[model samples]
Target: MKKVSFLLSASALSAIAVPALAQDVVFKPVVEARLRYETVDQAGPAPLTSSRDANAVTMRLRAGGEISKGPFAFLAEGEGTLAIDEDYNSGVNGKTLYPIVADPENVELNRLQLQYRTKPLIVTVGRQRINLDDQRFVGSVAWRQNEQTFDAVRVEYMGVKNLKVDVTYAISARTIWGIDGGKFGSANRPTQIDGDDVFANVSYKTKLGTLTGFAYLVDEDEAVVALRRNSSQTYGARFVGALPFTKKVKLSYLASYARQSDYATNPVHYSADYVAAELGLDVAAFKLTGGYELLGSDAGATGIAGGFAFQTPFATLHKFNGWADKFLATPGTGIQDYYAGIGYTVPKIGKAGPLVASFTFHHFSSDRLSIHYGDEYNAQVTMKLNKHLSALIKYADYERKGIASFTGDADTKKFWAQIDYAL
Candidate 1:
């Protein structure tokens, strides 16, 4: 991994651009920094690497600015990460001996774009970051120091009351793992999606709640068979809302469903289904939720020539399934996750303002067949020291069960501590 000293340089570049383009444009500069320490411990017999523990401490810095001149504007940002200690295996580094730490060391362009805006419609071109809804399908993977950005063109329309429509066409996906074939790399090769990709989303906000409909047509680079399977088309609808039954209590619910099928040059002729539902209630400063999710299987596809499951290859997987990332890839037999969690926001203590804490549990099973996959528990605590600084502590543990008979996943545990400063 290469050490990057561009944080100062990026600031200099932003300073130069904002003034040079100040002819008539309104410009706002953006800068943020984060320092994190992460550790992982995993144990499994078959696929176990030589080292079961990993430790990494890293820092990320970003600088950029947004400029607007009338209805036309421009934005550019740069990102860099410096790793002080790298005792873990970064998949790309062939550090196969230790547990994996996906965060790599590198410097690169994060976002740059031009925009045209009107009262009813807006258009953007170049490389940018895009997030939809809760980021279940498409997201920037912001949890990682580095971000996921896309080279594309996007259009948004908000002419109608309570409704907005967004459409985008992307040529490539710049992953957080940085560029492919670099030191401290990730397991995902190419580190990008280089092909025709389209995303369409329509959302309506109502007095009752929010309703959304979406279609995602994703095509992968055909040059590699491994990447070809990622090509697929999905259509879905989601509903989320809250109801204030009483002044002291509020109830919320989320329900979603989507259908997926092979697309483009994918050899697979399989179709699968996805379903997610959750219900929650807020009492006082505490909230509790219960949910169930299913990733249906293509157990009988002849063209694909193998067991296939409904997959969200582009989703921010860490936010769902589990934090241990054991289910990053849905198993061929599919999966069912029954989960529940609780969250609390407490009064300030000392220098830290308020404190937020949450805990969640998940039970996993095979969706198609009857089999116990595993169980997991996760806990997190966050505190804001001030306006610009925040602290976090999180942990995850997964215990394996019988489903390993079909899925080659492992049991793992992880811990993370971090502090972020924004300016």
Candidate 2:
């Protein structure tokens, strides 16, 4: 025979090329880089250029890859941002007298997915990146610089045992101002928003910790008209925990609640509520915190200044109420925050890696309107300049009292410096 039929056809093509080279060795590659410097000093009223101060220099780049087999997996990502010294107003670059540095510039295609897993269940599809939990009403705003994504279809279920269940539906919603950001009634960056949105979450884990429940339904069409009056529907619950108070101490807590109304082609009918609570303590590395939050108010049907409130508009609102961001919307006479903090870590130098410092304070008011929208002070320092680098320096200050029937405005400050690298 012809050399024993060529060694049985080369062992059947090496058993199909060794399982496709072991599925390309489970490909994986994702990179990240960020560099930023921001500054803003506000006191309000600068109709396009009287100078309220603003200085921004940004850079962000993300690239991606992911692959798998045996349950399927795939991912793709791309993001970019560049604005070297834009001197403010990046709300799609109108440069309105400086101030709002919403990080514009552009590049897109951030995340393309496909997944499937098992053990309980899991599934994902299309453009992704949905951050629930602590995102405080869904997120991915990722502190601007072009983030926020969706275009979904997601699912998860953890077959009980500590539980977990997630769901998503989405149709569009991909804003952070990239790719020339504009469309859908653009007044300043809209970059896609076609909605049908839906999200759900369920969590469980115990021993005094974890517990969640959520629901969100946001619907929009054509767009504009203030995002179709920001169509809404929400429901929530949260609980977080920690306890050990000894052996170096520990105690942490959080509680949350939510409620909202008006949905589908909303034309304003109103109903709102939201609340939060927090407490923390650590010891050993020192840490302390206190918090309270509320965002309720809604007096529709001719109640004057009460069309709506309790909005999140896809949160990550600069991590909440004031980073000098001065309430990223949610004040149709609603908002009440009171906060406190303290932190410290340091104690890892040599090869460089850990370091932290913090301070915070905030007090804002107005829920049903007694006004008093001000008082803030924050500071930070962070570092982890090692395995892939990290660094940050931040500050924020806000002071504006508002009393005579809400006069709030003027007095604000912000600053930041950051660097990051990852792979």
Give Cα distance to truth, residue 165, candidate 2, Å. 3.0
Q: Give the TM-score of candidate 2.
A: 0.32
Choose the strongest candidate by lDDT.
Answer: 1
The TM-score of predicted model 1 comes to 0.91
Give the local distance difference test score of model 1: 0.82
Worst 10 residues of 1 by lDDT: 1-10
Provide the TM-score for each candidate, comma-separated: 0.91, 0.32
Instruction: After superposing candidate 1 on the true structure, give the runs of residues whose Cα lies further than 4 Å from its correct spot.
Output: 1-24, 181-187, 303-306, 403-408
Per-residue lDDT over 146-237 for candidate 1, one digit per residue giving the tens place of the 0 to 100 score: 78888777899999999999999877788777754334433345566677889999999988789999999999864766578878999999
* Model 2 segments more than 4 A misplaced: 1-68, 74-76, 89-97, 104-116, 123-128, 133-135, 142-145, 148-273, 276-293, 296-314, 318-325, 329-365, 372-423
Q: Evaluate model 2: give its lDDT.
A: 0.79
- Give a tens-digit lDDT track for model 2, residues 1-423: 232233223333433443474645477899998999999887744332236588899999999877766766667789989888888878766666677778887888887766778889988777778989888777898877789987777899999899999999877777787766663334535777776879898999999999988889998664456677667899988999999969888999999888988889877778888999999998989999999999898866233455468777777788987787768777688889999999998779788858999998988888874778778999999989888988999999988774322323567788999898998
Per-residue lDDT for 319 in model 2? 92
Candidate number with greatest TM-score: 1
Question: Lowest lDDT 10-mer window, candidate 2?
Answer: 1-10
lDDT of each structure? Answer: 0.82, 0.79
